[model samples]
Every structure is written in C-alpha cells, then in structure tokens.
Target: MSSRLLKICLIFIAFLFFSCSSSDDSTPSEPDRSYEDVKTDFQAIDFQTGVNDVSIRDINGVLRFFRVIIPEGDLSSNLRPLVMTLHGASGGNPDAHKNTGCFAEEGFAAINPIIISPNGGNLDWIEFANQVLVLSLFDLAINYLPVDDTKVVVNGYSNGGNGAWFYGETQPTVVTASIPMASSYNTFNTAGEARRIDVPMYVIHGENDELFPLQRTQNWVEATRSAGTEITLEVAPGLTHNEPCNYVDHVKNAAIWLENDVWD
Candidate 1:
C-alpha cells in the first residue's frame, strides 16, 4: 500500500478501537434496585413539624393541594391523633377548611383534604382521579404529617360525608374512625373486595332532611354497624340536610370518640 493509504487505514482502525472501548465502558448499568428490592419503608414518626398548602403530586401525577393541621408544641415521639376532614363535592378547599374548622380550631390537629369543585362536571366522588387524589393526601399525611400515625380519623359532610365512607372502606388501615354527615348510601362496585374495615363510624343525619332522606342515611349506619363495626348514629330532630349539628354534635362526637377509642 502507498504511505497515504497506510496512514488512512491506521486512523480508521484507531477510530474503531476507540468506539468499541467507549461502548464497553459506558454499558447501561443495572437500574437502581432500592425502590424494588425493599418494600415501602414508611417511618410514620419521622417528621414532627407541620406544613400547610402542601401541593403534592398524586399517583396520576396530578398536582393536588391539601392543608395540614398539626399538633401544637413540639411533636415529640409521642404520637398525637390525626383527623382528616374532607368537604363535599360542591365546596372548594377554602370552604372545606372553614366548614370543618380544622384550621380555625387549635385543638384537633386535623388535615382537610380538598378536591376541587367545578360548576358543571360529573358530581360524584367515585371519579377514579378524585379517589386517587384523596389517597395521595392520606399518603402525604402518613409520611409527612406529625401525629399519631395509628390514630387516623376520616370525616366529611354531604358529598364529603360519602367520601369519608369511601375512604374508610377502601383504605381501612389509615382510617381509625369515620364521621359522615348528611350522606346517602353508596358502596363501590368492589365493595366485597375492599380490605376488611372495622374502623369506628359516626353517622350524623337530619331527621327532617328532604334532600337525602333520613332513611337512607340511617340504613347506611345500621348496615355498617350490623357488620360488627363500632358505630354511633346521631339523629338531629327537625334538622335539614345541611344541619348546624355538624359543628355542634358531629364535632363533639368526634372528639369523644377519639379520646376513648384505640386502633389496631
């Protein structure tokens, strides 16, 4: 070969060697096995501080907003109870916070999980995305909210009351007590498949509720209680669906229940 040809062939060989060596060195590594190898490591007592207006990405990668009510004073290893109150499908986050008094009251240390309310849309809490949003809020509270992880309470009114039942039945582990008011009866299509729920429930319904007849709400309470679940059914006489008893009786009942009950 000519000298020029010999030089070109040497350069081509060097390029080939470099490419092969680089490929070998940069082979894709085995993926991080930490997430897969270990089950979800949840230290429920890690953070003692409280955060509000927490915008967390849910299971569907949607950004949902939540307000957390943390216990007063230093959150020592001593676990304090956590109560989560969800507002009905008709109300906004601010309304939920206001109605439940979770932010106004300094006592409960509760979290109000808010799902947005649109003027015209499917008006049911069964929407899969909505449920996932609620679950994500629970996860955020469980992982971040400083409280007694074991004493989680779920409560709501109207659309929110139904949501309380749904969450109690679906995520039984996180729900130690349930408070539902002015709610109609509803069971998910996967009701039987739901994790067994023995969580104590408190039902608040108006005797004169014309919107959702009292019978239905009463039946819901009786059915759940007959299933051997601890429950307290309070019937407010001469009250409408949107009864003031939510603030007076329901909140009082919730306080009493939490003070006495212990969850497994």
Candidate 2:
C-alpha cells in the first residue's frame, strides 16, 4: 500500500476505537452498591411501616444521609408515588424524621406514598453539587424501589422549603408539585427559583413566622402568581417558625389538593 493509504487505514482504526470507547463508558450507578447488591437490598427491605436510615456516596465521595419511611403493606402494589420531605437548615435528615413525624403522617392523608428525607448538611439546594447528589439519590430510589417517577411531591421547611422551590423549578417535568412551608424566598437562587416554577406549587407560611419573614414570601408569591404559574399560598393563622408540627393540617390540605386537583 502507498504511504497515504496506510495513514488512512491507521486514522480509521483510531476513530473506530475511540467511538466504541465513548459509547461504552458510563458513570457508576451508585457509589457502594453493585447490581447484585442493589437486588439484595431491595429484597431485604422490611416493607413494614417504619423509618430506616440509608446512605449513598455521591460522585464526590461524600456520604449523603437519608431517612426513608416504609408504608405498611405488601410490596407488590403498583408503582407508588414518592414524597421527598426536606428538613430545615440543620441536622440533616434526622431532624426532619424525628420532628416532622406529623408531616410524614398527615402530609400523605389518603395516599400512602414512600416518604424520604435527605440531609442537607453543609450544602444548600441551590448548589449544583447538592443537586447532583440529591438527583443521584432520587434516581437510585426509583431504580431499586417501586417508585412511580411521574407522581413526585417535594415538600420542605425553612431551607429545605427553598430546596423544594429549587427542584420544582429545575425538575418541572418530573415533579408533580411542591408544598413549601415557612420557606424564605430570599434563599436558593435568591428566590429566583420561585419565578420559574412550571409545576403546580402550594406554599404554607405562618402568619407570624419570625425567620424568613412571611412578608418576603408573600412578595415573591405575588410576583410569581402575576406570571401565571399555578401557585397557592396558605397562610396559617397563628403559627410560628419553631412549631413545625402545627403545619400538619396545612400539609394535609396540600395533600388533598394533590389527590383531588393535581394528581390526575
């Protein structure tokens, strides 16, 4: 062969090898669990009504914490909806699980969905790193558990409420709706996230919240509503920042709104 033809053959071989390698490369599904290990954990789930502690290592090698609430029933039911409950500013998922029992219980009034609370720790919802970790965890749950990806409800309080708004804005197509309580619009994109909510959003704020003042939330809510997004703000009569349990009834209302109005 001539030198030119020989060079052509080498170039084609290199191109083919690179194409195949790029096509085959993929990120690991989870940090620790193998495919068989995932199967084992899925099978080992108690499937009873209780809270279980779970952790997943993100691509950054950080251990993300989560508390999952399993419902009382057989696991053979059709794919179930998932309620992601985000805690406030600190203590991560444990703070949410212990103090917000009223929320997990009454928030799902009629629809018994799998409840998961992720620990925010040092990262806030607005950060790209946190979004990656959270979305990875979410993908893991949907893959291993019987989760219906279509009907996802993200509810949050304080900083997590800000996260609720962030996800609703970022994952509008996947998230069915959001119920944010006592969340400040001044957080997570500086509440710029509130302006981009395409999915239905129902906000619950105390009339007398000292943290992240109610008026700021109201201001953003009004602005967002002017843009024609479907949003409802429910102002609790006399609730305060510290009393999360008091918002159970409000969350119950948001649940009814989801079942009767939104979750078609």
Candidate 3:
C-alpha cells in the first residue's frame, strides 16, 4: 500500500475504536416519565417534604390539582399518616385550607401527617364525580408517597364537609376516620338512607350557622347515632357558617382526637 493511503486507513481505524469505546462508557438515557406514569411505575417520584402544588392525572385520565404539605425531614424509615382535605362548594380555596384552615400546620412534630388539599376545578366537591376524583388522587398519592394506609383521614368544610360524610359512610374500609365541619348533608336525610356508617366520624359545626342551621347537622348526627353508628358532634360556640378562618381551633382538637382517641 502507498504510505499516504496506509496513514489514512490507520486514522479511520483509530476513529472507529475510540467511538465504540466512548459509546460503551456513556450512561443509558432514562425514559421521559409523566406524572400519569408515576401512578403505576414507582421510584421515579420520591417521598418529598415541604409544600408542593402537584397536578396529577387520575386513573380515569382526569387532570387534578392538590396542595400537598409534607413534614420537614427524612420520611423513608417510617410510614406517615395521610390526611386528604376536600374543598367546599365552588372549590373552596385549598391554599386557604392548608395555610389558613391549618390542616397542614399539624403536619409536623407530633401530629405529623402528610396533608393533601385538593382543588376540584372549583366545582362542588360534594358531587359524586368530584368525590371519586378526590379518592382517585388519594390512591395515587398512596402509591407515590410513603403513607400509613391504615391511618387515612378525611376532613372537609361546607360542601366538602358533605363529601367527608359520604366517605365516612361509604368508604369506611379505606378511611380510618373523618372530620366534617360546617357541613349540611340533606341527602342523608332519611333514617333508612342515613342508617349505617362503618367508620369513626367527628363533626364540627357553627352554632349560629346562617346558611345551614345547626339543627340540620344535629338531626343528622342523632339519626346516625340512633342507627347504631358512633358519631361525635362539637358545636363551636358563636361560630357562623361564613367564618372559615375561625374553624382552626376546632380542627386542631379534632386532630387530637384522631391522634389520641381514634388512632391510638
């Protein structure tokens, strides 16, 4: 072979050898996984802390938004309790529920449970479809986060309070306890329909509720009790239906009940 031709061939061989060696050393590219894929596939999303506004797609392919508050620390060793909050009619501000309503406040130190306050497209969460969507998100959160499935708690206000009642009665197996505040559920009106509730429910109501009278809630509690369901009702003195911020104390006590009375 000619000297010039021989040199060109050697250069080509060196290029090929280096290219193959470089390819072997490179790390494989990871697949682009969406939040929807995280519902089934694990390890991609991790158990995280702090406040996060997560938008996830449910099993039925419905897009949903929730404000999650995780405790500030490592959470891998132990499974933490989970609280799923349902917003009121017209999608009561979930941010307010976490910040103002103080559900997320209990998510540290002693009452440290993961809090999920969901926004149901600003629609009435009491609707069957919205409730199902909230439950779907709850299931997805369980798969993605480290949660103590046995201590799942549901809490809501106003129309969302009605949603809480629905889960307490219908989904007792999944829900460990429920706290329904300022809720007026007329649908569970009849004794026969309101007959049975399998889970522990602690209710909080405004004494001077303007839109929904305190009597409405009392009657429902009495009905459920009469039907052999153990329910507790705490009427906040001088509280009104419109005052959402004033409900913090009552909710805090309810958290105590869950931690000390119910879960322990």
Candidate 4:
C-alpha cells in the first residue's frame, strides 16, 4: 500500500475505536443488585410508626444517637427509598427530622421512605466523629430496613449541608443524590472535591440568608457545575438562615423533582 493510504487507514481505525469507546461510556448501566439480594439483605425489624431514637457506638467508642422515622406501613410488601438527613452544627437527630420530615407530608406518604437523621453533637458534621457516625448509621439502616439502594439521598441543613457535599462527593455510589440546604462549601478544595461527585445534587438556599449568604452558595454551585457535576439550585426569596422551617415546601418540591425527573 502507498505510504499516504497506509497513514489514512491507521487514522480511520483510531477514529473508529475512539468513537465506539465514547459511545459505550455515554450509556449508563443499572446498579449491581438483584431482587433476591435486596430481599435477602433486608431484615424484619420492628420499625415503629413514627420517629424512634436509636444509639450505636462510633469508631471512637462514643455513643451516638440517630433518629429513624418509619412510616405507617409494612416494609416487606414494597421497596422504599431511604433519605439520610444530616443536621447542622449543634443540631441533633430531632433537628434533622424536623427539617426533612415534610417528605412524608408532601405526597410521599404512599412511597414513604425510611428517614434516618444523625446528630451532629454540637460540632461540624465535617468532624471525624460525626462523619463516622453518619456513615455507620447508613450501613445499619441498609442492613436493618428494606431500603431501595438506588434511591438513597443524603440531605443536610447549614453545617450539615457541608457534610452532604463531602459525603455525596466521596460516596457517590452509595448516595444516589444530594440535597444541601442553607449551606456553603467550607472545604479546602471545593472544586477538586466537587469534581469527584457523580450523583445528582439539588442545592436549596435562602436568598436573604445571613449566615451562609446566597452569593457564597451560588459561587459554590457554579464552581461545581463547571466541574461537570449535575446540580440544581433553588433560592428562596426573603428567607434567612435561622428560618429553615420555611423551607419545607421547597424540600417537598425538590423531592418531587427527584422522583419525576432525576430518579425516574
């Protein structure tokens, strides 16, 4: 073959290989779990009607308390999603529950998720103790409850929102999506860390937030978007940092969006 023809053939072969590889990479695959595996892993625990406080020893041997809200139903009949809520600084399980329980009220009762809220022990959720405690609780919930692993969402408020970013970035496989509210990225390498996150993220912030401020959250969201992460931001008008209770409606909307748009 002529030298020019040989060069053209090699280039064409390389292009074909690259195109095929890119096409394969673009198609997403389902999670590696069978129906039998989910059924076998789920335990028959007496999940109470409302919220229950459960305690477990952390890696450092400190007793940590987490709240679980099992909606009124039988778990064996259906597979339900799980939502893990991380509380802000100085906040505990009750606070987390208060912030996220609206999921049950806002048209999610039929598909009620097992909500687990972890206490932040008055320290930032980024602290080692809190991080260990939260991750441990996740394992415990998955083993004990009939959780739909693919729909796990990690959500947080304020300082806990920071934790959401960390966990959602580091544990994308386990946490299917992240919802961070009234929070800003305080990590040393925000963009670098954000780049590692592959799950969908929904960020909600109060427009008039004094503590974290709306502009800061907007900057973080933009940076994360630049890193090629799928994220959505919802800014509540005239709301402040201390008024997270006002965010229940917004949270409901986010949950619906996740159900119809992201997860579906």
Candidate 5:
C-alpha cells in the first residue's frame, strides 16, 4: 500500500477506538445480577416494613449502595418517592439506617450510597467523581426498583451532610430536595459552586456542635439564599454535634420541606 494510504488507515482505526471508549463511558452498564435474581433476593428479605440493605453497581464496576425500602406488604403499588440518605465520616451503611430511622418508618424508599470506606477517596463532599457514582446508583435503583423519578430527595449527616450539599449542587436535575444535618460546608464564597442548586433544602445544625459547628450550615443557607435558592436553616440550641433530638427534628422538617416547599 502507498505510505499516505497506510497513515490514513491508522488514523481511522485510532478514531474508531476512541469513539467506542467515549460511548461506553456515557452508557449505564448493567449489574452482575439479573432481574429475576434481584426479585428473588429481595423477596427473601422482610420487605413488609423495614430497611433493606441492598447493593447496586455503577458502569465502572464499583459496588456503591444499600437501598432502604419501606415496604407495604402484598399491596400492588406503583412508583414511590425515594430519599437517598448518606452517612457520616465515622461509619458506613449500617449507621445510616440506625441514624435515620424516621425516613424508613415514614414509607419513603432511600438508597444509602456506600462511600468508599478506608479512605482513598476524599472525605469532602464536592468531588465530581463521587457525585457521578451516587448518580449512577440512583439510575440503577430507578431501573431495578419501583421508584418515582420526580420525587427523589437527597440527604446526609456529618460528612454525609457535606455529601448531600455536594450532590444537590452538582446534580440538581436528579435531586428534588437536600437535607443536611450536623455538618455543613464552608461559606458560599468558598463552596458557592453548588449555590446553583435551587432545590428546596432543609439544613439543621447544632448550635453547640463541636465537630462541624453552626457556622458552616449558616454559611450554606446564606449563600444558597443569596443565589436565589430556597434554603431553610434551623439551629438547635444546646444540642451537641451528635444529639439524637436534633436528627429527629431534621427528619420531620425535611419531609415537610420536600412536600410543601417550592423553589425558584
């Protein structure tokens, strides 16, 4: 073959390989489990009325979540709202349920996205890669489970609180409301990139919080509101960073905000 023709063919082959790789990245990859497998395994659990710790995968082959479904046994139901609840820096999926029992009892399905434990990934919530993993988990849940897409909510506590802020700001289209408890990000000027999230948000932080303090939540509320978003901040006085009552009220207020609150 002529030298010119050989170079052209090589270029074409490279282009084809690059295009295929790009396409693969955008598409949602299927999990190792089949639909029947998911059903069979799900049925084995007590879906009648408690949290189900389930796992789903992303396109890049990471096992990333536990779905907390509040089941209403034997009843033929359609799509239901979902709350994606994330845990703090101290623990993983186990503590997520133990901490947010109110959401499970209220019959709202939640997916507790498993943060990469043991720390290679950043503890900070704003990383785009982490956001992508969480979003992929949501996509997986929508397909594998009976969930209403429009009614999806995102929430977290402590480190997870920061994660909630990160996800809400980064992927606004998938998240309807954001509720963060105990911990919050830096000021809007520093973390204001997420201020574009105009979704209804409820932020609760303890006034005496030693770990994350009230100032972070205050800054988040102020920044979001300044950016023309609807955000509510509740400071629980005399409550420490780990107070149970603060969490109780956080859940209560979150549910209300998700239902009646409107965004600009």
Candidate 6:
C-alpha cells in the first residue's frame, strides 16, 4: 500500500479499537431507589405491643421526650406504617397514646401502624424549638425502628392538631399526610402557612369546642383550600373542648382513611 494510505488505515484501526474498548468499559447505571426502597434488615425491638418512652436532648439543648407503640407482629416480615401523634396542651405522652387508642388490643389488630407521640414542652407546636424537637424525634424513630419511611402520617388532638398542620405544611416531603383534631392554628400565621403545605390533610373538630370553636377550624380549612391545598374537615356536633372521649371513633376512621384513601 502507498505510505499515505497505510497511515490512514492504521489511524482507522486505532479509532475502532478505542471505540470498542470504551464501549466495553462503560457500565449500565442502576435505577435510583426511593426512601421506600430502603428497609431495615431486622426488627429494632422485640415486637412487644406497648408504649415505650424515649428521652433525648433536642437541637436547642432542651430535654425532649416521646413515646412509641409497637404492634404485636413480626417486624422482621413486614415494614409497617408509622404514625406520629402529637398531644394537646397539658396532655402527657402516655395519655395521648391511651386517648388515641392506638395501643388498644383491638386497635392494634385493626390498623397496625407504629405510633410515636412526642411531647411539645407544653408549648404551641408552631414554636421553632418544638418543631425542631419533633423533627429530631422523627429522625430518631426512623433510625431506631423498622419504620416504612414513605408511609408516615402526623396527627394530633387540640394543640397537637395545630402542630400537625405546622409539620404537614412545612415538611410535606417528610410527613406523608396530616390529621388534626379539635385544633386550630392559634399561634402561626394560618394564611401564610397554608401556602406552604403540599400534603393531603384530614381535619376533625367539635362544632361546640369551647377553647377552639369550629368556625376557626373551618376558616383555616377554607384558607388552606384556597391556597390549593388538599384538605378535608369534619365538624362533630355538640362536642366540647375535651372531645377525645367522643373522638376515638373519628381517629380510627382517620387511620382507615390514611391507609385506604390517602396512601392508597
């Protein structure tokens, strides 16, 4: 072959060899896994069905407390949904757990969600420190339990309901849904806060609640809905401020709604 043709032929062979080598070295990328894809290998606790108290210092250096209720099941087999319950003002962690009936024998057999109730230091949940504390406790729960990160629901009564709105509005990505009962946002800027909420919400309140009247909850719901938020409000007739006694049914229904309606 002529010298020039020989040079061109050699260059073409080198290019083909480099292209084949590059194709061989390239790897097919793995699909991205979401939070739901990640699972704890074993049960964090021994699957005892009761309330467990947890205490830890929050980001603000304040001593914070929370309670967890594990259902009677083999956590090793299924990753259960998590429900973070907030208590009303002056309500204890255990009291909130009992009031909600989340740990009741029948209740556990029904919904089977892992429950976490965190104390708000007797302050409004809109308080920055309390918000930080609640989020911190959530992180701790996920790390310590066999919690399904994708199926987290935040619900509360009275003051806790208020906190539920706060977390549901601000941390939509973290909390999947919100259920607030007998609560109104008396502390936060409801109109401004509503614009930030992106998750679905189920709100329940007593029509005759002396502390937080039903109209207030209605107004908040209206404003939130106007802000393009998905919310449903249920007003119980003749119910008063301390309506938890008459509200357990609503709570159970909400749990069903969370499972079948929202998450489904």
- Predictions in order: lDDT: 0.52, 0.69, 0.67, 0.66, 0.54, 0.64
* lDDT string, candidate 6, 111-201, tens digits: 6878877667657887766665566446545655767777888888778888888888877657889888888773226345545368889
Question: How would you encode candidate 1's per-residue C-alpha lDDT over 47-105 as one tens digit per residue?
Answer: 23343333333222333445554545655565566666666665333334444443124
Ten-residue region with minimum lDDT total, candidate 4: 15-24
Estimate, for each residue in 1-264, the C-alpha lDDT of model 5 and write its tens digit: 334224333333222111111112344454444434433443454433454554443334544434455546432356666677666764333334354554323322222222111111333445544554455445544544556666667777678777777767655666777777776675355533645465677777888999876776686678667778777887877888775444565566566656666421
lDDT of 3 by residue, 89-199 (tens): 653443543442343354223678888887766667756556555665566556557788788888888887888888777666568898898998753544456575888
lDDT of 4: 0.66
TM-score of every candidate: 0.65, 0.76, 0.76, 0.75, 0.66, 0.72
TM-score of 5: 0.66
Model 5 alpha-carbon miss at residue 14, Å? 18
Stretches > 4 Å off in candidate 1: 1-51, 57-62, 91-98, 102-123, 187-197, 244-246, 262-264
Give per-residue CA lDDT, model 2, range 1-264, as digits (tens): 334224333333222111001122343433443434433554565545677765544433455556777677776667778888878877443344455485766767577888887777766876766665455445545656777777788888888788898788667655778888899864224645535468899999999999878899998888777777788999999999988888988898888888888976
Q: Write the per-residue lDDT of candidate 4 for residues 132-221, one digit (tens) a residue.
A: 556655655665577777788888888877888888887764688988889988423733564435889888899999999799789878
Superposed by TM-score, candidate 6 places the C-alpha of residue 217 at a distance from the truth, in angstroms, of: 1.3
List candidate 3 stretches off by more than 4 Å. 1-43, 58-62, 91-110, 187-193
Q: How many backbone clashes does candidate 4 have?
A: 0
Ranking by lDDT: 2, 3, 4, 6, 5, 1
Residue 239 in candidate 4, Cα distance off native in Å: 0.5
lDDT at residue 138 of model 3 (Cα atoms)? 63
Q: What is the lDDT of residue 50 in candidate 5?
A: 51
Range of the 10 consecutive residues with the lowest summed lDDT in candidate 5: 15-24
In candidate 4, stretches whose alpha carbon ends up further than 4 angstroms from where it belongs are: 1-45, 59-61, 91-111, 186-196
Model 3 misses residue 214 by how many Å? 0.5
